[model samples]
Target: MSELLNNSHRRKEVLMKLLMRLHEGESPDTLRTELAETLKGIPYAEVLQVEQEMISLGMPAEEVTQLCDAHSSVLSGLVDVGDAKAAPAGHPVDVFQQENKAILMTISQVRQELNTAIQSSGEDFKKSVIALRTHFNHLSDVDKHYKRKEFLVFPVLERQGLTAPPEVMWGKHDLIREQIKGIHEILLNPELTAEELQPVVDLVIEPALYALAEMVTKEEEILFPMCMDSFSENDWAQVHEHTLEYGFCIVDPVGNWKPTHTAETTAAKVESEVQSGHFQLPSGRLSAAEVQAIFNSVPFDMTFVDNEDKVKYFTQGTERIFSRNRAILGRNVLHCHPPASSNIVERILEDFRSGREERAAFWINMRGKMIHIEYFALRDEEQNYLGCLEVSQNVTRYRELEGEQRILSYGEKKSD
Candidate 1:
């Protein structure tokens, strides 16, 4: 009886070690294959013990991330020789991977053109540089994409004692952001002669492209696989809920994820219980009256027009960069503008309705302030015209912004 008990304990311990390797993504091959069928029912505590032992043995987190992938592949293979489950279409991981792939592809395209422009010097060179800047600015949206992942995805991983991947990914993100800024500076200076372009390419653009490619690989192989392992259906369900708030890089999410029965019930209860009168900020609760007062205190004027091209609402922000009043509400949007521009506004509205144009933008000097204005068409389900939104902000300071201002200061918090 003593011998049997000792042997049973030994197998259990061995089985747990194998499970941890699988979770870390390492493959012990035959050991994993043998235990795969038997490991399903093991409690999470036993699984965690194996991971703890690995850390105690001094294996790094990165090595663990790599090994965990291998382990997952092996066990996944045992389930079916060639039929491992693919990520479902539009799974957050799948969609995020697709976006990352596109970003790398765009970076590659831009780099090639930048290189070609460097080899030639003439009138065409300035055109090429301008084109390069346009393409590079598109990458700004990628920052938004990465930030969404940091806020929405990293928190869940942290709950599982995973911090290494987020730290590494964020570090890479900062590097890419810096490279992009360096490229902007190089483009702005007239010193970028053909001879100077090579250094810019090597120092700024090449590193940026390589970083972009490395990030793609890291996401596909390491970061995403770990997310798949560490997240539950419910966790992903939460990520799907919040991803749209930040938007995407190149792709619009195909369909919005709706809450299931339990989630919907919980959401309904919370919404019902919470008062809508105030927004609770980190500083304090802002009442609805206070919210209006805050908006009315901004430097820029604000307006909203529904799909029908009818003026619906406008903020009474102080220091009105463009004058707006309560009288504009419920007015035909075209009539709100000067008659000389009414036809142009009508054409813009028509194009918006037909989905031919997403935005109508213009900028001009007004009262010594550079006012940048844009109109965006809004559409709802079934792609019906919902209305247009017009936002006009004084961009005198915006156009003059040179280097980054990362830390928020007094004026930085304002967004119109």
Candidate 2:
């Protein structure tokens, strides 16, 4: 029994079995007590790996999401909070830390407004209600922040074989999302009296507000540190680049950050001369160098996925709407989106596969730019299904065009 408990392989087997039971609807309290004794002295990172491995082995995401609340309950007091370190300005971690400050401040203001409005009536209460309403609305922007982590950051972490932690956090993200939506829905009923608003403050708004604030603590202490320790410099650079598409929560990033490689490493990989090559395409043929230059020079960004549902390629643009890095190659496209939108993605893939749909289009107003996104299903000459191509473009400048001009004016021409 001593040797069995001491064995790392045995420990993982036990952990998986416990989690499987938990998924099978075993009592969380019972498992928490039973497993706590067995799991003592196990590194938190190892525990996270256990869960990630379970998910990858075919456990349902929904089931894992449900099990986490209970699973976390067991680890709550026993496990130590993760390391917390200061992130430098302009780094991806720095951006998240900054946003947490803004989010916490908003929650504080909402609390004050709720306190003042609960006892007051008439215009005073109405004014306070309006303030609370706006606070929660602004709080809704947190979804964009969560989406960045869920879509861009998590996939990279999973690629490195750290899957469980991201899955658990993604679950919490879903819970918080539902809470925010509930609070938003409660406020949509404008006819409610001051008395009506009080319950919302107590039941809906406060719980959600507190949850949001606590997640900041979780991100600072648990998520960010683990990511910092595990991810490489280039990995962070990839995350920073992708954040542009999702936009920030309420915080604005000050500038670009370029992670520097070590001098020794750079020296090791340096070559004497550049190797050149050519490529052929249906439209025309271009040298290998020209292919990349053309893709970057174009006003749009693009990503392609093969029929196996794997990400094959993405173009780098002067201003990327979303971040793309070589690390994402061969990753399952399903894992590339937030849980909220993954359903839509699956439906799109299913439709294309079934020959019910050939192409789909969507557009959104992001930070004053009209960003257009389109997906086309690829098929061969014999009509054999191949893959899906995603094309995204910022049409803000194009939308402002008026009148035809035969003359070519290139450099920022202005009409007065």
Candidate 3:
């Protein structure tokens, strides 16, 4: 080891090589000792500064985030991102921080309920469940937080050419969501006994609550700070305006700070840069909201995977055969499935991309309902492969309609 600290140029060169090694498939665990020796005594701001430099040089933020996450094993000792500055009243970060506090409180309550259940028996067991249900339901607020980040904030970052980090975070959001959903399912099970539910409560529920805690820390330490540095005042203003539409997590939005420049100041410069209103296609014109409504009104659930195999959107039909939420949006198609099922998802995308397959269909019986799932390859007029679309429908009622009647349907009568 050198007797003196390296100069700025030397330090940055070392940081880049370290990131490159991790990018080349070096396991974080294997590099832990070396990382500790190299960066352990260094301030956390170094990590942040190097990552910002990478973004400045056109490296994707997500790639930097991935390397950061992989090396997070040593972040506890080496990185002191320092105390997060307090966000003012009505500031976007303020609202998120408030929600994070609420989320943590609920998670604590859930732990208490679990301890009570562990200490109780028979009638006492049922009594503990009473408290458990409330805590579990409170955690549902996380969905709103995630939705705002994905739909409202991510697009702005994408416009700024930072897509990967948001995608990685969305994947984490989905994982958290699935765990929360599992906890909910346990709450709903009629025959669920304390003994049977104990393992799930411990493994699924506790891990999820802790994951949420870690996410809040990551947001405060890394994500939010990065956004503060990267997003423009107008971008923050627009995001702040749209955030209310998705609603809040555990806290309300507060703050009266306005940007120095409003839409008028940025209009002409960002007109086309801004994405709003209707899409003018050759077939027809419909605003995004109208298109969403039409998609929901349709009889089946639909999902669009983009050219890079990222999940771009999914329609929230009334009776969707599969479950979906904003967390899955912009997530990689491969991560959306379980490990065992990922092979099929990858094979399908390969076939679609290679122009070897146009469509794939399958049917199954789920919870006494018939499910018909299909995937189709999407292409441009020149046959350039675009992506894949997945549509799934519940066909139980359709299967039972064996005979047709000449009588007008009830819907037809209303039209007449």
Candidate 4:
């Protein structure tokens, strides 16, 4: 172990020797055991340094992933040594770990099933191939999962002056994402026969599975440990609250975390103590007080655009399925969308302004809620051009309505 640690060169050289020993038909358990012991009791970043080195040395991504996972398992028991606290229920760390575990298990199962498909009979063969592709679609959730970590968790770590691991991990994440997307597309449109899937199995699917597995290890070992070391309890609490907005990859947490002191009430009390001016709605005849009430009372979100197509303002609805803060006010409407989507937004605005289209619609399902969105051109009393009105509402219940009745049937069950 001392000889293993004392080497001045990167650990990748040692790992290559160890991996070569395995390939050379030598017993690998001794070296693996030795490596694990050296990794134990070290700072998780040190372990990650070894991981990066191993990857650079032509060690299979899977082996490195396994090494990281093994390192984490060892550290899981010793985590109490640090000032780190258990991720309170629904904490980002807790949610990430739970979701990641399920994804890893699913990836493991898919890999095994595909392996069986390669060696199996006729009926089992097609079934395994289809299962592999179907699971590939499910793998998209893994990308979404990691994105949250990159955006949310990485920023917090960066603030603490630790930046290297997240960036490296994000790069590996992109590679894994591309591999999954490629495999999924191949499965969806088969340019390759089942026999040809063999290389994909080796090159794309296998490496991806290993990459995800390694990430899980790095998260549990390096990322989470470092986070726990760096973040305050309040930071975890804030993350836990935000988790509700983005949600988890696989795990559905049974409960939520609530701050001991209510930020909601404190905020409300502060707001009540402050002075706020009433707002004006697009309806020209309405009073400011009435406009405020009308906007707040409606069951939908509302936004206004001037005749020139600049986004003038948007209302803040508490039940908004998608967040829209005042920061977006007066910003170019195109800037609200992702770069890839800006052109489409501009086209819509053009059509609306030219009278080629007076309205456009779009909707999405989020967290089991179906949200309906619509944009309409608002004309004046003279029927001359004015602006566009954007309205969005949660229509989950609205879409379920059947035959309409005039009377208030109120609380009673309706017969089909």
> Which numbered prediction scores highest in lDDT against the true structure?
2
Model 4 lDDT tens row, 278-337: 445575555565667678778898888778655566676576656765334444555455
The TM-score values for the models, in the order shown, are 0.49, 0.53, 0.53, 0.54
The weakest ten consecutive residues by lDDT in model 3 span 407-416
RMSD of each: 17.4, 10.9, 12.3, 10.4
In order, candidate lDDTs are: 0.65, 0.74, 0.71, 0.65
Candidate 4 RMSD computed on C-alpha atoms after optimal superposition onto the true structure = 10.4
Off by over 4 Å in 1: 1-85, 259-261, 264-416
User: In model 3, what is the error at residue 133, expressed in angstroms?
Assistant: 2.1
How does residue 218 of candidate 2 score in lDDT? 62
Error of 1 at 227 (Å): 1.4
Q: How are the candidates ranked when ordered by TM-score, highest leading? A: 4, 2, 3, 1
Clashes of each: 13, 2, 6, 0
